[model samples]
Target: MASYGNDKEDYLKRLRRIEGQVRGLQKMIDDDKYCIDILTQVSAVTRALQSFSLGLLDEHLAGCVVDAAAKGGPEADAKVREASEAIARLVRS
Candidate 1:
């Protein structure tokens, strides 16, 4: 919410689309689709998730992190640390 702010609706819409994609992938597997086709869809999903994470990270850096740094306090430091850790985890995924 901090990163997305007023654009919550847009983010949710994107997530819904990704959910549909995942459901489609499940259906394809259930239908015994080709292995390559399933792998292709899985790749697409991975990319989509990465894109989503990047967008959130951008917003967080631009808004929350920037505000925190400007304030310069324990709370600010904590926010920055949290953001860094979240980004690291995202990259690992």
Candidate 2:
């Protein structure tokens, strides 16, 4: 199992909520909801996902990445680059 540390419960709860939102979006699609309304919901879901990603990224940087960097090795640099690329992709999306 993955360890989310102190924010595990909160993160899981948020993820569940996001799942429900996605379900709701699916329902709206089935009901032929308005395009603007559907788009709004999509935007909300995207923002929520981004928020979750940011939280996890912050934790990774503070914990795993930092710890690795303190060791002053190639692995640490790789982690830093990986984290940077991940954030860039998130932002681009």
Candidate 3:
């Protein structure tokens, strides 16, 4: 449930499409696709995943993080730390 409940279906569909793209990549490799062409597809998949992650992060910030901050206690601090860690991980990737 990392995704907002109402947005879950959209995320699922996006994931499924990315899954198909990955399978397509494998097939292309099996078929001896050009190296640059394969690399291009890989880039596309990476961008798609990053976009999806950012969307989920936005939702978390707008919902869970905001709510925790509003409460102004240990939970709020934890939420901020959690978000910072997540951003750091993404940046490293």
**lDDT on C-alpha atoms for all candidate structures:** 0.91, 0.91, 0.94
Candidate 1 segments exceeding 4 Å error: none
What candidate 2 gets wrong by more than 4 Å, as runs, is 1-3
Score residue 16 of candidate 1 by CA lDDT.
96
Output the worst ten-in-a-row residue range by lDDT, candidate 1: 1-10
Candidate 1, residue 90: lDDT = 94
TM-score, each model?
Answer: 0.93, 0.90, 0.96
The residue-by-residue lDDT of candidate 2 on 1-93, one tens digit each, is 233588899999999999999999999999999999999999999999999999999988888888889997899999899899998998899
Model 1 Cα displacement at 23 (Å)? 0.3
Model 3, residue 50: displacement in angstroms? 0.5
Better of 1 and 2 by TM-score: 1
Give per-residue lDDT, candidate 2, residue 23.
100
Q: What does candidate 3's lDDT look like per residue over 1-93, in tens digits?
A: 453888999999999999999999999999999999999999999999999999999999998899999999999999999999999999999
- TM-score pick, better of 2 and 3: 3
| List of clashing residue pairs for candidate 2 | none
Question: Per-residue lDDT of 9-91 in model 1, one digit per residue for the tens?
Answer: 98999899999999999999999999999999999999998999899889888988988899999979998899989988997
Clashing pairs in 3: none
Model 2 scores a TM of: 0.90
Arrange candidates, best TM-score first. 3, 1, 2
